[model samples]
Target: MNWIILILAGLFEVAFAFCLGKAKETTGNEMYFWYAGFLAALSISMGLLIKATQTLPIGTAYAVWTGIGAVGTVLVGIWVFKEPAGFLRLLFLTTLIGSIIGLKAVSSH
Candidate 1:
């Protein structure tokens, strides 16, 4: 259950980051909407992280959450923003995922 919450929190982090990126180009009311969405997602994500930490070690939870966000952001950037999909970039993302899994496996939780 904690893992599930942590995963969703990470996804929210991704949403927050994406919204922030989009907000930069927006103006006035448009920017305000994106900013609000970003703030809401950020708050929810942080709340979930704090909750998950009650059951999971802070180090493990933080690393996993960041890993999820980073991977999601990279994938979203590639798919939605048409960013570069170079071989090296993908390889590093896979490596990061492997490290996240390794961390979880070794953790007491």
Candidate 2:
């Protein structure tokens, strides 16, 4: 269950990051709403990650969270915003995933 929660928290981290990217282009009243939402999601996700770290090693959990969030966000940015989707970008993303899994496995002991 903790792992599940941690994964969800990481997903939320990605979501908030996406929201921030969008909000960066805006500067009116609507921007504040997006900023507020981003802040709330970021804070809650970080708190959840901290709670999850009670059972998981900090390095392993943080790596997983950051890796997933960054990869997911970049993927979304490409699909949703038509950002660059080059082979090198995907290769690096794959490497991030591999390293995250390796770190988690090694730290699980």
Candidate 3:
């Protein structure tokens, strides 16, 4: 259950991070909404992640949470924001995902 919450929190972290980038691209009222919501969500998610880390090992929890958030955010940035989507991007993401899985396996025992 706690791990589930941590993963969900990480997803929210990615969402807020994307919103922050989008907020920077916009102007006026929409900017305020995006920025505020992004910051609020980001903070809350971090808190939840920290709470989760109390039970889970810091290295494993942080690695998995951040890896998923970063990978998802980059994908979103590529598809939605038209950011670069090249082989290098895939390579790095793949490595990070593998590392996360390895760390999780080691931590489980």
TM-score of each: 0.95, 0.89, 0.90
lDDT of each: 0.94, 0.85, 0.86
Q: Whose TM-score is greatest here?
A: 1
Off by over 4 Å in 3: none
What does each candidate score in C-alpha RMSD? 0.9, 1.5, 1.4
Model 2 lDDT on a 0 to 1 scale: 0.85
Pairing residues by index, what is the TM-score of model 2? 0.89
- Each model's total of backbone clashes: 0, 0, 0
lDDT of 1 by residue, 12-108 (tens): 9999989997898789999999999999999999999999999999999999999999999999889978899999999999999999899888989
For 1-109, candidate 3 gives per-residue lDDT tens digits of 7788788878988889889888989999999999999988888889889888888888788888888799889888998899998998889988988987787778863
lDDT of 3 at 82: 93
- What is the clash count of model 3? 0
Q: Order the candidate numbers by lDDT, best to worst.
A: 1, 3, 2
Candidate 2 runs further than 4 Å off: none
Tell me, by lDDT, which candidate is best.
1
Give lDDT for model 3: 0.86
Error of 3 at 63 (Å): 1.7
